[model samples]
Target: MRNLLPFRSAPAPTSKVAALAAVTAVVAVAAGIASAPVAAEHTDAHAVVRDGQNIRYAGLTVRIPAAGEGVQAAAQSTSGDISLTVTRSAEGKLVVKTDDHEHGDEDHGDEAHADEQAEAQAVTADSARPAAAKTCTDRAYALAGWKLPSFAWYYNPAGAPAAIAGTAASAISAGTNALSTACGQKRLGLVPSYAGQTSAAVQVGAAGNCIGNDGRNVIGWRAGSGRWLGMTCTYFKTINGKKTVTGTDTALNTQYKFFTTTANCNNAYDLQSVVLHERGHSLGLNHVSQSANASAVMTPALSTCSAGKRSLGLGDYQGLAALYGTR
Candidate 1:
C-alpha cells in the first residue's frame, strides 16, 4: 500500500516583501543609532514563535514549524499547538515540526477548510480518479526519521499537583509504553525506556513555552497559561554528517488541570491520553485530522477526561511501521 501521510515540507523561503520591510527597518535603526530605545520581543509559550529564531542551546539554533503546514488539523476545542518535534538539521539548526490546533480569534473558518485540505493532499484511490471522486477519509500521516533503537528519558514531577502526583510516573509510563508497543506483535524496534527521576529541569520557558533543546531527555510539569496543554521538544544533532536524535524534553501545562483516575476526572484532561499523544510526536509521528481519524492517538486534539488515546489506532500503527519497519 502507498504511504498516505504528509511529509515535512522544506523551510519556507523568505518572502521578498517581508525581507524588504526588514531591511528598511534596519536602515532606520542604523540612521537613529543610539537615539532610539531598543527592545527585542521575547519568545515564550504565550508569544507567537517566529519560524527562524536564534534560540540556542548547546550551539544549535531553532527552526519553528510554519502554521497550518500539515494536515490542516486545527483544534476541535481549546486553541493549542500539539505534537511538535525539535531536531537538528544539516546546518545544525533544530528543525521544529508541529501539529497545531487553534481556536478563538485565530479560527480556521470551519471544518470544511480542514476537510478540503486533507482531501486535496491525500491519495484516495489506487489509480487516478477525478477530484470529485476523492473522499476526506483519505488522509496522510507525518514522519521524522529516528536513528536510535531506544531512547532513555527521565521525569521530574516537581510542579505537578498533589491530586495525581503520586501516580504520575506510572500514568506517564503507560503512555510511553503504548507507543513502544503500538506496532503490536510485529513489534517495531523503537523503545522509550524510563530512566527514573531526575533533578534536571524541563527546558520550558517561564510561561510554559518550549525553550531551546538542552540535550536532556526530561519530562515534568510547569505552570503556564494560554491554550497549550503540553509540548515535546525533541533535540537532534549532526553526527557523521547525519542529523540524528540527541534528546527530548516534555512539559505538561500545570495551568490546566489533569486527572489520572476516572472518578476524579472532573472534566479535566486524561493524563495518560495526553502523554500518549505527545509521545507519538516524540516517536516521529505527526497529526492526523481529528475529524477524519478521531480515534487515532495522533489526532491533533482531545476532549476532557477522554482516555481512549492510551491505545494506538490503525493509522497510528501504520505511521510507526512506515518509519521503523515492523519486526
Candidate 2:
C-alpha cells in the first residue's frame, strides 16, 4: 500500500519512500492505523517508569515486529496488566495509548498535586555523554555512530487556548535557541515548519501520543493521565543496512498545569524546561542522570514548576558542545 502520510523529514530518496511503503502498507493491512481507530479499550495504565529495561532510558518499551507486517497486533503493552495499544507514527515513532483506561490513582480535579507526584515518578528519555572533556564514548543512551544533526519540526496547537499555544510556541522557540547556541550548529536547531495539514492523530481525554513528519505536534487533555507531563518518542530509519535515526517526535500532556511566566512559580511545570529536555533528544542525546544538587537541562526527571532546567547547565552543555561542537 502506498503511504499517504505526509512527508515527515526533509524529502528522502525513492528507496526511503519505498522503505516506508512497506511499513505503511503493513499498517494499512494490520489495522488500517493510518486512519487511526476510534475504538476504546480498558487495560493497564503505563508511562515512563524507572526500572530495569534496556530501552527504559529512552522512556519507551520498544518492540520490532516482522517486516511487511504492522505492529498493532504485537505492540500492545504487556509490561503490566493495563492495555496499552502501541502504534507507529509516520516518522516511525512508537505511539502508545491507554485509551479510556482508568487507574486507581487518577484524580483530575487537583492537577497541581497530581503533577507533583507524576513529575517525581516519571523519568524523561535519553541524553548524551560529554567528550574527553566530559566523559568518554560508549554511554548507553548516546546515539553512537549517529547524531541527529539536523531536522525541522512543526507545531499543531490542536485547538489549545491561544494563550496556551502562544506559551508553548515561545517555550519551543527558546528551547531551539538554547540548543543552537550550545551546539554551535544552526542546523541542529529545530526550526518550526508547517505540516500542511492537521491531524487528530492524538486524541483528547486519553493518553494521546502523536508525531508527524511535519511539525504538527499535538497537545491533548484529560485528567486521569495527568501525571505524564509529556514524553518523547524517537523514530529510526535504516540506511545501507545500518540503523540511522531520522528524527525524534515529542508530545506534551495538556492535563498538567503549565506556567509560562517566570514569576508566580506555583506548582505548575515550566513549559520551556520540558521542551529543552526533549529538544536534546532531537539531537540524538540520551538520558544523562543529573544530581539534584546540580541538575542539568537533561535531568532524568524534574519537580513540578521547576524552571531551573530552562537554561543549559554544565553537564548539559558539555555533552551538547562535545557532540555538535561549539563556536
Candidate 3:
C-alpha cells in the first residue's frame, strides 16, 4: 500500500543541473535515506535544514570507480545523463561529485565553500566525464531494464511503514500500484527488481557531514548482475525511541533529524513517496532539473506535500515510456 504524504508546489530548477551537465561533460558523471521521518520539505536550494538544524540534499550522488582508464571512461559517458561531473585524483581514484552550484556562492559561508571545494577536488582526482547517452528519457528505459526490484523503509515505527522495510516487497507493491494507476494492467508485471542492496552511511549534524557526505543512502551496480544495491541505516534508540522502528535510520542522530525538524520520527512522512523516488533511481532515472513540470516526481526538489505528487508525474512516465517502450 502507498502511504500518502503532503505535496508542495515544485520549486524552480536550480543551477545544480547546469553545473552537473558541465561537470559531467568534463568527466563521465556519476551519480538515500533513512527513517520513517517525514518526507523532506521542499526547498528552493539544493540543501535543506530541518528543525533549524540538520541538513540534506534534494539530490543524491552516485559514486564511480577511480581506478582503471576503462572505468573512468564509462563514468564520463554516463555522467552526461545525470548532469554530474567526474574527476580523478593523483592516486588514480575516481570521485563523482554532485553539481550543487549554490554551495559555490560566496555568500553561502566558509563551510559551504569548503565543502564544495572538497567535493570538486575529490571528483577531479579520479573522475572523468561519462559518455553521452541518446537522451535522459532513453537512458531511463535502458537502465530500467537493468534494475532489480527494490524498496526502502525507515528504521523508526514513528515513520511511514513502507519506507522502513527497504525490501523488495514494498517496492514491488508500490510499483504495481503506481503502474496500475498510470498505465493500467498493460504494464503490471513489467516492474523491475530492486537488487543491489547497499546503504548510504551519512553523518548527522554539521555541513560536510550530510547524508551524501557520509556515503550512506547511495547504491549502484555494474552494467550486469541485474542487481541494485543502495545504502541504508539501522534504527537506534538515540534516534527513534519506539520499539518498532519502521524506517531506515534513527531519528535525532541521523541526517534527517539534523537537517529538518519538520520530519517527525514516528509519523509525518510517507513510505511510498521515498520508495517511488528511489525506485526511479533503481530504474535508471536521474533528477530532472531542466523541465518545467514541477509536479513531476523526478523534479530536482520536492517543495511541499500538498501538491499530491507522491507518484510519478507525466514527465516521469513519459521518460519511462520513451526508454522501455510503453507496455
Task: Residues 1-327, candidate 3: write the lDDT tens digits.
Answer: 111111122242222221112122122222211112222212233332121112123332223322231110011111111122223333443322233322222121111121221122222111111122222222111121122223342222222223333442443345324632242213533344333334432222122221323312232211211111122222111112212111222112112211112242342223344445544543444444322223444433322222233455544555555444544
For candidate 2, the TM-score is: 0.50
- 74-160 per-residue lDDT for model 2 (tens digits): 011111111122334444443333222222232111211111112322343222322332322222222222345355555555644
- Candidate 1, residues 1-327, lDDT tens digits: the string is 111112111243221221111111111112211122222221222211233232222112244322211111111113323333333233322223223211112112123122222322232211111132122123345454444446788999898888998998889998888775442346766767889999989886544345656666788987755456776666554456543555667778777778888788876888897887777766666555555545556655566766656767655666676666666
Full candidate order by TM-score, most accurate first: 1, 2, 3
lDDT for position 79 in model 1: 37
Indicate which candidate wins on TM-score: 1
Candidates 1 and 3 compared by lDDT, better number: 1
Model 3: weakest 10-residue lDDT segment is 69-78
Stretches of candidate 1 off by over 4 Å are 1-77, 80-140, 145-149, 240-242
TM-score of each: 0.63, 0.50, 0.37
Off by over 4 Å in 3: 1-24, 27-97, 100-172, 175-190, 193-267, 303-307
